[model samples]
Target: MNIVIIGGGGFLGQKLARALVARGTLNGTAISRITLADVNDPAGIEGASLPVETARCDITDPASVARVVTGETDVIYHLAAVVSAHAEEEFEDGMQINLFGTLNILERCRKLGTAPLMVFTSSIAVYGGEVPDPITETSLLNPQTSYGAQKAAGELLVNDYSRKGYVDGRGVRLPTISIRPGKPNRAASSFMSSILREPLNGQAANCPVGEDFLHYYLSPRKCVENLIRTAEIPAADLGRNRILQMPGRTLSIRQMIDAMSAVAGPEPARLITWQPDEAISSIVAGWRFDIHADRALALGLAADASFEENVRYYIEDDRPGN
Candidate 1:
């Protein structure tokens, strides 16, 4: 099978590419060629176990995205986006990349004449505003942030295209991926990792939310695993909806800090000091805190058992000097 991963340079995107290359197979199907496309060429992917290709393409530009997606591409993993905080700060850039970028990919798939399975990495932000506890697939979306609105819009487009037979698409609504490696970015959730990562290296970190603030989460490994699983699931099983509320563990900010402290030390926890930011708190407050994920669980998509396991996995796999 030939696979194309858009946004392949990003942290999660690179992780998924490495996993696909390491496994060399998916659902008993052999992976023949893997194409990694992003605005910047992916780095540190040398000595891959399988045949790999790279391309620089902007997902926001239809012509540019089409140039790389053409020819025997069996699967497309759409992981490109402007991220949450940046989207909220720069609304126009967020809309252009998060929403229009997805449209460009779907349009390219339609013109291909061959229905390739498109796995879109959506966000939990899609379920915002007045959301019910344990948000289900049936929950109505009322996104308050620009990022959430764009992602929700993308999910709709993916479902509509699937219904129209333009592409075999599945939008997996990802939880807030925790214990991410490396330095933080512009994302509001970047603090989620900084609180753990910075302190481990003897640096200070800030906690923008209250200790009691609740949110749903998953590990980076589990996120990539669920993305691959979504590709393997049968179209008939997904039905007309084409979107899945991914499995995750719901916990508070304090719970996550405690888990990290247990794995690392009290010093790491001490580095995390509470300092609320209204902009971030306002956007995050509207986000869905939990999900049912019955459809995803029944379909064999897996998630991390707890916040503790997620933190431990990060320390072992991506810790500095490991």
Candidate 2:
């Protein structure tokens, strides 16, 4: 099977590529060729067990996207986007990358005339505007932020393309992935990582949200695992529902601090200070606090046990030094 990853140089994208290379195949599907495409030229992988290719293309440009998808691509994982906070700040850039970029891919897939499966990485931000606890797959999307709006629109486009038999598409709504490695990006949820990442390295971090503020979370490892499983699952199992919510555990900001305290001790916990930002809080307040991913679980997709497990995995695996 030939597979293509759109944002293969990003944090999640790199991990997904490594995992695929490690497995050598997915569900008995022989991965003969893997293509990594991004605006930034990706570094070539050495000692790869499977054949891999790299392409520098702007996903927002239909011509560029079409050029890369000319071959026999059995599956495509669309992970390219400007992210939440940056999208909110740069409205035009967000629309071009998040909304139009997805359209470009779907359009190219349609023109390919081959029924290749597509897995889109959507954000939980898609569900906003008075969401109940344990939000279901059927929950209405009332996004307040521009980023959420773009993602919700993309989900609709994916569904429309799937219904037209242009492509087999699956959209998974991801939660805030905590303890992410590397410098923080512009995501409002970056504070989620900051609270843990800085303290683990014996540095300080700001807690934008209050202790009682509850939010959903998943580890990067689990996120990638879910994406792979979604790609391999039979189409018949997917049925009419082309979109599914990923599994995640809900915890308050305080619970996260407690987890850090248990792992890194009280010193790191003390480093955390409350300093609210209206912009971030306003955007995050609309986000769904919890979700019941019955469809994902039925399809054999699983998540980490708790927030503590998510943090522990990051420390052990990424091992960010102070």
TM-score (all chains, Cα) for each model: 0.95, 0.94
Question: CA lDDT, every prediction?
Answer: 0.86, 0.85
Query: What clash pairs does model 2 have?
Result: none
Model 1 TM-score (2 dp): 0.95
Please provide, for model 2 over 154-215, each residue's C-alpha lDDT reduced to its tens digit, 9 standing for 90 to 100: 99999889989888999998988887887766777889888888878777888887889988
Alpha-carbon RMSD to native, per candidate: 1.6, 1.8
**How well is each residue in 1-322 modelled by candidate 1, as lDDT tens digits?**
9999998988888899899999999768899988889999876468998888889989888999988888698899999898877898899999899999999999999998788889998888877666667678898987777888999999999999999988999999888888788888887788877887788778899999899988888899899889989999999999878999888888888898888888877888888788889988986777777788888999989789877888788877788887
| Backbone clashes (count) for model 2 | 0
- Please give the range of 10 consecutive residues that has the lowest summed lDDT in model 1: 126-135
Specify the highest-lDDT model's number.
Answer: 1
Clashing pairs in 1: none
* Worst ten in a row by lDDT for model 2: 313-322
Residue 278 displacement in candidate 2 (angstroms): 3.8
